[model samples]
Target: MQSQWGIMHGTHTTPVGRVRDGALDLLKWLALLSMVLDHLRYVGLSLDGLYVPGRLAFPWFCLAIAANLHRTRNAVVTGHWRYLGWLLLFSVISEVPYRMFIDDADTLNVLPTLALGLLVARGWQQKALIDRGLALIALILGAVFSSQLMFGFFGVLLPLAMLLVFRRPWYFSVLPGWVCVAANQWQILLNSGSVVALTGLVACLIAPLAGLMLLQYAKNVSPPAMRRWAYALYPLHFLLLLLLRKALA
Candidate 1:
């Protein structure tokens, strides 16, 4: 855990030679922006169009987690636990605001889904007994309570699948994209000819590939590194948005 704590700090303050990943920072910012815009739809305005961009939020976030995990391959054991702890803590803290702001939340907050995704991703990467055991536990829980999770079974699997093809060819992302669509419970619409179906498929496929492009080609463009403090924004944004709703009323 001391090692992870060092990582927690090293993320914000790195050595001179440790060049920060600008594109990764950009993707994190993008995820945060998409989340805010998506929630704006509920602010009682004609913001339905925000939904499409909002759909970009989760997949990018999942990729960011996977990418970070990959970069710190040495710290998977400690890092994942620390990561899971933060997500679980915020999952509890954010639920009230999430439920308050959304009003139609039928499931737990997104953190639990992300937490389980972390476990799944790690399990796939390592064959250790502890890793597989924990992954199996999360799998059963995620499965039995599918409807109660933010994205359900496939959602829990999306991060693991994305981790599998993280730096592979862009075309490979389509595999996890399918998993994403399934996670969203919109697989039935995949073969349909509707506008929403196309939008869903496009967002699923593009979100991850776009993040990969940022990672591979946007190296020179420096973006602010997203650190631990960013987690505060999740619940804080809910309160801010809630205040906006009050003002609007």
Candidate 2:
């Protein structure tokens, strides 16, 4: 099928050049902001009702990853490696603050999960046995460490599912949406009576379509700066939130 980036079948061309899409950067910033608001719930806003906004964070990040992958007309391998590296680096850096900010949190935060999802998507895209095997290992690790703060095993899987259905059709997000619901079942059910739950459900259902639409319709946005410090934002933000929460307490 044809997409804004041109034809969508087969492997992306090699040595892909930079594709500037500002909407993605904007979305990333929005997602990050939403995540901060959500984390604030733990700090002192449990009654303030910002959790729903926070719900947009993970899916948005996943969508950004998928959008980046889709836009790279070539250099799939380089893109995958670079993405994986960034995720890994941030995963390590973000762990301490993630644990400190979220009481009793055990997971390695979302970056690692995203890294795993990147592996899964890259493997699926490349059709390589080794990559597939690595993806399975990552999935297993995610499950074993499910107690950790980030989305756990299911969280890791959500992005892969998102990548799978990307650009296919609007209806494709349903399965992933169900998976997302299952991943956060109790919370979803508890929030069901309220608009938050409804919106969360709808977001999961439409995330892929929304992401695809953004990429296709909003490709004119500038790409985010891919710098080392950008990754640090994850941990730094957590620390800042932690300090603010402590002060408020």
| Maximum-lDDT candidate | 1
Residue 85 of model 2 has an lDDT of 87
lDDT of 1 at 233: 96
lDDT of 2 by residue, 48-101 (tens): 467666666787787777666665635646656777888888888888888888
TM-score attained by model 1: 0.87
Tell me the TM-score of each prediction against the true structure. 0.87, 0.83
**RMSD of model 1 against the true structure:** 6.5
Candidate 2: segments with Cα more than 4 A from true spot: 1-14, 186-195, 223-226
Separately for all candidates shown, the number of backbone clashes (residues 3 or more apart, or on different chains) is 0, 7
lDDT of 1 at 83: 85
lDDT of 1 by residue, 26-55 (tens): 988999999999899888888877777887
Best by TM-score: 1
RMSD for each of the candidates: 6.5, 3.3
